[model samples]
Target: MEATLSVIGGRWKGVVLFHLLKGKKRFGELRRHLPNCTQRMLTLQLRELEEDGLVKRTVFPEIPPRVEYELTPFGRSVEPILVGMRDWGEKYKARL
Candidate 1:
């Protein structure tokens, strides 16, 4: 659990993964979705996830250039864990 938290606990990290679960997104698209996060922070988080083998980053050469991010197979493995936490949080909130 400690290790898991270390990888996912940074501010906005979990939120980044949560939104990526929906589908692949460009850097600008992710920025728009995560409006509260600064560009530098988002870039760092994505690099960490990539290093962890949980996220894939693809670059395309073009006039404007393009980059996309998506979850890897290992990253998809984390979905159930996130869902479980969500369920537990909802139940706990009800008790409050």
Candidate 2:
């Protein structure tokens, strides 16, 4: 449990993972999704997730290079947990 939290416990890490579960997203898209998160903080969180081997960063060579973020196979393994959390939160929120 500690290990799982260590990797995904950051303020926005799990949220990032949850969004990525939907599909690959560009940096701008992620920023839009996490509007409350500071750009620097999100950047830091992404770097940490990438370092932990849960997310993959791909850069395309182009005039205006494109970068996209998606989950690695290992990252996809956390789908159940993220989904469960989302479900539970929804239920809990409804109760309030």
Candidate 3:
């Protein structure tokens, strides 16, 4: 469990959570932001977040189809942590 938390603690998970803070987003939208990430990896991360009860995915019926992901209250609780990480990252970069 500790290892799993660490796995989803940073990297694309934080990025994904940051975007979700704005509201819901589709898979493609997430892809646009994290251009270097592969579809398979993104899918896996999203599934993990969902399993951890941090994200909620909704699907809609349409011609092209629609799927959206948003944060749950549990996930929203991590906003301050994300902000602190962003601040720390900027400070670390400035020092380097």
lDDT of each: 0.91, 0.97, 0.89
Q: Model 3: per-residue lDDT, tens digit, 52-78?
A: 888999999998999999999998987
Q: What is the overall TM-score of model 1 with all chains considered together?
A: 0.88
Provide the RMSD of all predictions against the true structure, rounded to 1 decimal: 1.6, 0.8, 2.0
Which of the numbered candidates is closest to the native, going by highest TM-score? 2
Candidate 2: C-alpha RMSD after superposition:
0.8
Worst 10 residues of 1 by lDDT: 77-86
Per-candidate TM-score against the hidden true structure? 0.88, 0.96, 0.89
Ranking by lDDT: 2, 1, 3
Candidate 3 has a TM-score of 0.89
Query: What's the lDDT for residue 21 in model 3?
Result: 90
Better of 2 and 3 by lDDT: 2
Residue-wise lDDT of candidate 2 within 13-49, one digit each (tens)? 9999999999999999999999999999999999999
Best by lDDT: 2
* 24-51: candidate 1 lDDT, tens digit per residue: 9999999999999999999999999999
Error of 1 at 7 (Å): 1.3
Where does candidate 3 stray beyond 4 Å? 1-4
Instruction: List where candidate 2 sits over 4 angstroms from the true fold.
Output: none
Superposed by TM-score, candidate 1 places the C-alpha of residue 10 at a distance from the truth, in angstroms, of 1.2
